[model samples]
Target: MTSTTPRYLRPGKGTKVANAFARGVTKLGISLWGSRVLGVRGRTSGQLREVPVNLLTHEGAQYLVAARGETQWVRNLRAAGEGQLRLGRRVEKFGYRELADDEKPAVLRAYLARWKFEVGVFFDGVDASSPDETLRRIAPGYPVFEIRTA
Candidate 1:
């Protein structure tokens, strides 16, 4: 069956503004609602690329959800398999393991539950209360990575 999730959604002016604000706040040691700057080495350029992301902790494990779906950072994280998350002067180096499509529903649900107000539109109306089947259907579009401290 065809997936319902969008392949990509380019950031708009508003998104750029929000990201800049989040990055600025995070740089100042202020975590805006669990936001952090994720830095991954570019797959081709070999330079670090940074972007704002929401950090989700479920059952004591931390996760990174690619709300924008198949974004550049997602590709970089896939190729590099590790990266850093920064909040002010604190930097956490981490190894990432990509969750298989079938393994993502629970994580995705929890992620939506936490950031639905900010990222729900990207999920095509699926929310924390959505059925497993619905989340499963949209899982491929949202790349979820389990973060391990390095």
Candidate 2:
């Protein structure tokens, strides 16, 4: 029997290796294409968990898109409602508001535009150049969150 997990949402071995590298390098004060160490408390354990994430800016707002669909950080962030973005020695704590599917296309487009080479695979065949209709159609599969700073 096949696993119920969607193919796009599953991180393969290479993705895992790359994420590990990104996390380690970013924590060491180096950023790869503006990657940040996202620290959010675990929903069940209450311990802070981190993964290097691409920080996207669009229309003067900061966003974090879950190109890999609903993963651990997405669940934890949803439960915690706030998290930290760390780059180098600096850490900024912020709250997040999950955007509706209708609100996701623009940010997702911007995110895809910037890091398509790295994350395009997760978006299936859609890309920054994809039509708005296509983006909206796939919007629900990708979760977009707006970062709110205090």
Candidate 3:
């Protein structure tokens, strides 16, 4: 049987447009549904850039993950390594770390289920594997971050 390839497997004009649109939509969605405000200091210069991201609970603590590691905001968060989180009217600074391999899948599943429909449109041509694989391939570049108490 011929293997069904990922859309990124065939990069063309349509793929380019879809990818771009996905980024735009994701940014909008975060601004709307994301409940927490995050600020990342510029690693070298010490400037603060902030954005909203979906806050998640895993193992009874709060965390956030970049569905597509392509997000510049996530890059900024990484560069800073530590940041401030504001939920509702409260705020705190926290150290952040990328999650290990075994920790990623469950967090990914939670994220995809939270943002189901948008993911479908954004990640066109991905095979809907089990509910499990759907989450994994929903965003190949998924990167998870855990927040440490200040």
lDDT of 3 by residue, 6-109 (tens): 22233358656754554344444433354566778766668886655667776677678764454656667777678887654466788877877566667766
**Whole-model lDDT, model 1:** 0.92
The list of candidate 2 runs beyond 4 A from truth reads: 1-8
Candidate 3 colliding pairs, count: 0
Clashes of each: 0, 0, 0
TM-score of each: 0.94, 0.93, 0.63
> Which candidate has the top score in lDDT?
1
Judged by whole-model lDDT over C-alpha atoms, candidate 2 comes out at: 0.90
| lDDT string, candidate 1, 18-124, tens digits | 99999999988999889999999999999999999999999889999998888999989989989999999999999978899999999999999888999998888
Q: Which ten residues in a row are the worst by lDDT in model 3?
A: 2-11
Residue 39, candidate 1: how far off, in angstroms?
A: 0.5
What is residue 91's positional error in candidate 3, in angstroms?
1.3
Every candidate's lDDT:
0.92, 0.90, 0.62
lDDT of 1 at 78: 87
The pairs that clash in candidate 3 are none
